[model samples]
Target: MKPYPFSAIVGHDQLRLALLLCAVRPEIGGALIRGEKGTAKSTAVRGLAALLSEATGSDAGLVEMPLGATEDRVIGSLDLQRVLRDGEHAFSPGLLARAHGGVLYVDEVNLLHDHLVDVLLDAAAMGRVHIERDGISHSHEARFVLIGTMNPEEGELRPQLLDRFGLTVDVHASRDVDVRVQVIRQRMAYEADPEGFAERYADADAELARRIAAARALVDDVVLPDNELRRIAALCAAFDVDGMRADLVVARTAVAHAAWRGADTVGEEDIRVAAELALPHRRRRDPFDDPGIDRDQLDEALARAGADPDPDPDPDPPGGGASTEAEHDAPQQNPAQKGKPQAPTTRPSAPPSATFRTRALRVPGVG
Candidate 1:
């Protein structure tokens, strides 16, 4: 089915950005979208899948985990059909296997059974799945982007499971009349004729995918300067986030944010944005303390860390083509170095090696 176009989604810019960031670099782990029923959480996921499909030229299958799904069905199970037909007990892969290299989205995740949540958390953390059931043992790589949606009114997730997710984005229905109207009109337009609506935004979706692809290519080169690393650690310390995961994730996320903006290195601006997304959920929980950051304090700390305040130009728009690497011996796509090349430096010719060595043997006292 054609999904509602991502660009057509009315507002919730942060929600949309978090989802896209997770997609661009799954290593940042998953994003937990918390909101009420009509906040377009699931719609955003489907749109992301569609966006990935257009970007990578594959379906980018989105495997939905049903609330009532059994444990065996979720992890893996014995192949009854294979056993009966061939007299052999084979291990049948489950949702985790199918979700490899795609997305595993669970709506109402807070309401899922404790066991099920544990299973997912284990797989997500390990980046692989191993199952032993009914005398069948099998293990294989299973890495997929994880997304979970929840309504706080329904329940709360375990702290353990909540921290498993790399990022969290709280969403609510749009209160602005114009935005609400646009959301409704877009929904109606999509429902009225899904194909046409999708087709209308095809170019924009493709552009978005290319932009993500370029950012993915460029992310590895977007280094964090020593000051940025210090800043990341300082931010984590300020929040009193648990473990080293937040520090490492914040560093990597700053790199990604810089890459997304087509910068060659992580900067203060990237740190601010990355900290907002990476540090919020990881903060020590206090009922009285706000879950978000203190913008003023963050700015002060960043300045004290000697962060550069220079603003960069907006990144170039993605071109209409696949932004993939070339094969061996072929020229690199060099997405990070997309726009320009620097002037090459040259060295002056040196004197003959034998002549230089003989002449350098004289001591200062003798001379």
Candidate 2:
């Protein structure tokens, strides 16, 4: 299928940003796309593949691995004929090998078998795959930028596998009438004349490619300041996130944003946007909750960071500390306190009951 040019995608700023981040830092892990059908998820990935192909100077385009593919197709298998006839091992490179240094797009990823998912996850996590089947063994560098698309209506991915993704984005159908009209118009034009439509966006695509290359060069130089790092930490904590992955994603994504904008240092706005995108899925409680990243907490963090240098050490409370006092005085009991009274009395009851039952059972005629 022909992918619509990356620049021609109408309005998926978040998805675009996440994909860009993955391209900048493949170490940040892959991206997961969740949306309904016909939302252009696959189209966006293919467009990204085209953009990345240009930037990376690789002729091997993005490798598309369909769902429910066999293990032999994904990680390669031995050549049975060669082994039987000549006693020589021959290996065929699989999708992962072909995807080296490029993008690996998996459509309908949620429908893939658990074992195949594990294989992909292992390759992604280790940046290589090892084969030891059929008395043949070898390892190949199989690194690639993994991009997966799934429709939530079909099913949900296991949390373990979901957490492996560094970024998750949701794409919704277009709502604006004018934007929809534009989308339809563009599609019709492309269908009428694919090459001409592609040519029209050629310059735009080239400019984007230049920006991606420049951003890649600048990614290592982008600095995340102490204040921004602390803000990211506080945001992760406020969201009750589980691991250190959230913090790393926020920091890296913020730096990528800075690089993409041609800045050397990350700013508060960069961290804010990154936190919104990176921390929502990391939250352990209520992944779909509104204000999932604790907007109030983030706002307070930003205010503290941007406040005047010599301001008052203590600011006046809105209600003169009454709310703070009430919160302090609220009655509560620790688990230790609640269980102290019941610990000692239940230890002596079992032996006496046993003795009485034993004596009564010796006289069996009484009942």
Candidate 3:
């Protein structure tokens, strides 16, 4: 079925902007959308895919990553069907390949297995997938706008995977009765006639598509001044984010924002908006800490950074790519175990008076 138009969605200005910024500069990585159910998260991703398809003139439609998908299915493997049918050992492209130049939509991303999440992180960081299995060595471009939607109540992504996403938006169902009624009306109209409803907003979507293409062209050329870079660094530092990913994402996103606005140079507004989207998820110091940015703090940090006359750039700027060794090598934990209490370590009843050739025993393990 055709998706409801992107422009037609109401009351998610931040969500829409995050998606658009990633579209403008995919190097900013992609957008992770955190919200409760029935908030049009999937709808917006599909609509963005539609816009990308129309803009790029490629089959840039949405490729969904099902919660239960296996690594081979998510990344590509030997084509067993072809091998059986014609005795040809060909490779069967998976979701990553199919998602190239498009949007890889992962719904309930928090429910995905750790291995699958790792695969996504790798692909998002490198813009390609490499597989060496079944005596088949294969690699292909897998660049796409990674759109992950999750209900935080269910679980949380590991900090490594979370940091890989350039932007994050926290959305909620509108509480205003009038706005809720309008949402219902639009949804009902779309359900009643998807094509007709889509046609009504076709012009708007087309215009957005054009703008996205233009922004992509301009993003690289958009100048991020030293002052803006300092502001980004200060914002990340103020947030006390653990690594350099936030700084790079904010910088890239600010440039994208400038491009999206058709500006030749990035301004304070661009940096502020970028920090709002890029720093929220990165602000959590630990798994238990809540994911969000304090707006007043963000404003204060930006003001202070902007006021300071620091001609020097950030002392320790990250290398070209967004990926970091800490992020790449971070341990993966079961998503189900996230946001829950870990089993307590057992204490010895008494100090071991004599430890002779005893196997190293930790203690009673959780069942």
Candidate 4:
């Protein structure tokens, strides 16, 4: 059956963006999709693979990791049957090898064996797999985008494992009646005529794929300003996250966001969007703790890092092209609004006043 077109997937803006970011910049690590069943999670993953295939003009297939797969089957093993027949042991590539240069998707990943999960995460982070079994040892590149879906009600991954994912998004069925109706109508239409339905969205998928390719090519050249670096670090620190992984993930995610926006430099909006995607899961102090950062808190953190949490939009460049930080920061000159004075913007480094003893301002407890 034809995979549902990614553009046709409805009402999953964050999920779509997270998957695209990982596709454009795999170094940002893979995304973990947490949501209920029947929320189009699996469909979205398959569609992303198809979209990537269209975008790169290659067979970037999607390899599903079965729930009951063994370590040998997942990583690789010796071809015992071939050895018996030929009297020579040979390496047999596994799912990891088969998924090279594409996407390795694990459904119900939380239910998979902990050790298997470790193996997958290890390969994802290191971009290589090692096999040391049946008196034969070998290593090969296993660089592939890792995407996993899980229902939080079934179980939760250990914090150590959870922290490995570069980005995550929570998805839920839409509550709006109109959206629900549209989803059902689309599903029925696709089921009735899969080929025709796919053809209708092919152009859109191709256009998005081209954009993704362009972003991937430009991501390396996209500048990460010093102020943006400070903002990323301060945001992670303010959330009181466990370690430095959050900081690094936020920085990489911000750069990817800049490239996605066709911007030469990372802006405050890019950093903010990066934080929203990368920081929520990392900030959970306990399994039961609600996962999210307060908007005011995020703004304060940005302010502390010398950024305008809510800066004005960049003016359109003459003759039409990507916008630069210089253009965004430069004062605007619109004759229509020239008579009115614009509000002053400030971006100050970590001021001493911003740093004060919390205890000093605490009121005496009446309890």
On lDDT, the candidate that comes out on top is: 4
Instruction: In candidate 3, list every pair of residues with a backbone clash.
Output: none
121-158 in candidate 4: lDDT tens per residue?
88988899988877998999987889999999998998
What's model 2's TM-score? 0.78
RMSD of each: 18.7, 12.4, 18.9, 16.0
**Residue-wise lDDT of candidate 3 within 1-367, one digit each (tens)?**
7888999998899999898887777778888899999998988998999999888888858888888788888888898888999997899899999999999999998888877887887888889888999989899998899989999899788877887888899999999999999999998999999999999999999999999999988877889888677878877887788879888888888889899999999999999898899888777656566667777888899888878775665545577544555567888889999999989989869766875785765678854
Q: Point out where model 4 deviates above 4 Å.
A: 286-288, 307-367
lDDT of 1 at 237: 78
- Tens-digit per-residue lDDT, 1-367, candidate 1: 6888888888889888888887777788788998889999999998887776655565546899999999999999999999999999898889999888788999999989988988987887678998877998899877777899999889879887887788888888878998888888989989999999999998989889898888878888887898778878877777777889988777877787888888998888888888888777778767667666777977786675565444464444377443333235466666877787856879998886764443446677784
Q: Which segments of candidate 2 are over 4 A away from where they belong? A: 287-367
Of models 1 and 3, which has the larger TM-score? 3
Alpha-carbon RMSD, candidate 4: 16.0
- The model with the greater lDDT, 2 or 3, is 3
When summed lDDT is taken over every stretch of 10 residues in candidate 3, the lowest stretch is 314-323
Q: How does model 1 score by TM-score? A: 0.79
lDDT of 4 at 137: 80
Better of 1 and 2 by TM-score: 1
